[model samples]
Target: MAILIGTRDGVYRTATVPVEDAEQVLDSGDVPRVQTFPELDGVFAATKTGLYRSTDEGQTWKNLNVPQEEVYSVVASPDSERLYAGTHPAHLYVSIDDGDTWAELEGFQELPSRDEWHTPRHRNEAHVRSLGVHPEMSDRVIAGVEVGGVHVSDDQGETWTERRDGVHDDVHHVLVLGADEYVASCGDGLYRTRDAGQSWTSLDTDLDHRYFREAFELDGRLYAAAARSSPGTWSGEGGADAILVESTDSGETIETVSYPGGPAEVILAWTAVEGDVLAGTNDGRLISRDEDGTWVDAGMIPAGIRSLEVC
Candidate 1:
């Protein structure tokens, strides 16, 4: 199996799974995320430059002709033709034609707290950092904006309901665990809700490290990647004090997984393929844990990886 890697510089593909070396497949500037849509025979790349799509399994790409700014996240509904894209400067758009065209979900910008959705760094502009969709509910869509808040739309992207009742506003990623259960990773800590987004409870309040980048589930365990502080404080000397945590009780209690000795760095992205959980670190290290519970270096990329997906 081959895995697609979206990095700070470009997009690449490993020679093979349990990869040893990778080759740059697309030279798109700063690919933050890459996803595959089998329904449209498409491989989509969301980059700092713009959104691009390839129907030929990433051999070549064509601009979808939408979103001139950085597309932070992109997702497609399981049971509908609706496709969503979240961009920097905090905007949301929906595509019904497999990304051929899109319509801005204007209602998202009219939220009551929209004026307060601003980042603390880099021009004080927030971005839609992540998105989540439930396969069981076609109309249910969730968006996570960096330094903003998490919002959900039950009627597709037509309208949204924003809430910061429990979770912090500096959201990075959100995942629908099951049904109404949702988990959010934020700059403050990790939070989860058993009753959908109505209410949430902090799961990582006891952990000193607050910054989290990504979370995913593999087999029957929930895995999260965390850092000691924000990326701005991370340096090359020691990298970030990054670690991986596992929760067996669905984010209720977590235990730190052992790591190989090295200067700590944040694991910004994770993915599971063929029952193997893989992580990409801020120092461009592709690490994996074996059945024996040992962390081993799988491979490395030229630049820090932002996202990983099987294709």
Candidate 2:
């Protein structure tokens, strides 16, 4: 297996941990997400320039040519019959013929709160930073928009319903745990909704750190990380002041854990390879848990990692 690391500069591929050599596979700038779907043929990278696909384990890439230059997120339909791409300015597009062509999901534009989705940090525009679908709900699509809110579509992408009322607006990623359950990591807090976004519960109300980027689940345990503040405040001597937490009961409770880059570097990406849970940090460190349950630094990439994938 090869580890694909999506960084600020590009995507890098390596064969083993403590990486002796890492090759830059795709030069797509500012990769926000690198993902692989079981039903899909290759890995997909969503970058600021465009969306790209690599079939040979990141050896080569072909631009999917999403209409918007800044493709923030991409996901395949549960049955792999359709592909969805979310872009900056917070728009949604769908492609049925692989990546050859795409059409806008105009329903997303009709949201009642579409005009209020802009944030000054993103030049008064937001992006669909995350997309999710469950195997049992093939016609459903969940979108997490940064500076906006989470929205759900029942008939693929043809129509959407706003589910952002109680959740934080600066959404980053949404993990679909089941047909009706999801965990959303946001710029302000982490949230969970077991009733398909009908209502939400703030899982981070007891924690001091509120800024979250992503959440992962492995072996029935949910893992998440958070910073004391947003990225702009991460440059101080204290660094990110981040903490990693794990929940075995599906976010009902959590316990803090220490890592190699703790309190300084925040883990932004996660993937499992060969039964090992590996995480990439915003400071360019690749760390993994060993058989003894100890977190160790695996290697270092030149640039901060935005996403990770194993192929």
- Highest lDDT model number: 2
Alpha carbon RMSD to native, model 2: 0.8
Could you give me the TM-score of model 1 versus the true structure? Answer: 0.95
Q: For candidate 2, what is the TM-score?
A: 0.99
> What residue pairs clash in candidate 2, if any at all?
none
Q: Candidate 1, overall lDDT?
A: 0.81
Check candidate 1 and list the clashing pairs.
Answer: none
Residue 114 miss distance in model 2 (angstroms) = 0.4
* Candidate 2 lDDT by residue in tens digits, 1-311: 88999999999999998776988988888999999999999999999999999999899999999999999999999788899999998999999999999999999999999999998899999999999999999999999999889999999999999999889999999999999999999999999999999999999989999999999998898999999999999997899999999899999999999999889999999999888899999999999988887899999989999999998
lDDT of 1 by residue, 223-299 (tens): 98788899887886767877788988887789987665333777888887777888888777788879986778887
Alpha carbon deviation, residue 13, candidate 2 (Å): 0.6
Predicted structure with the largest TM-score when compared to the true one = 2
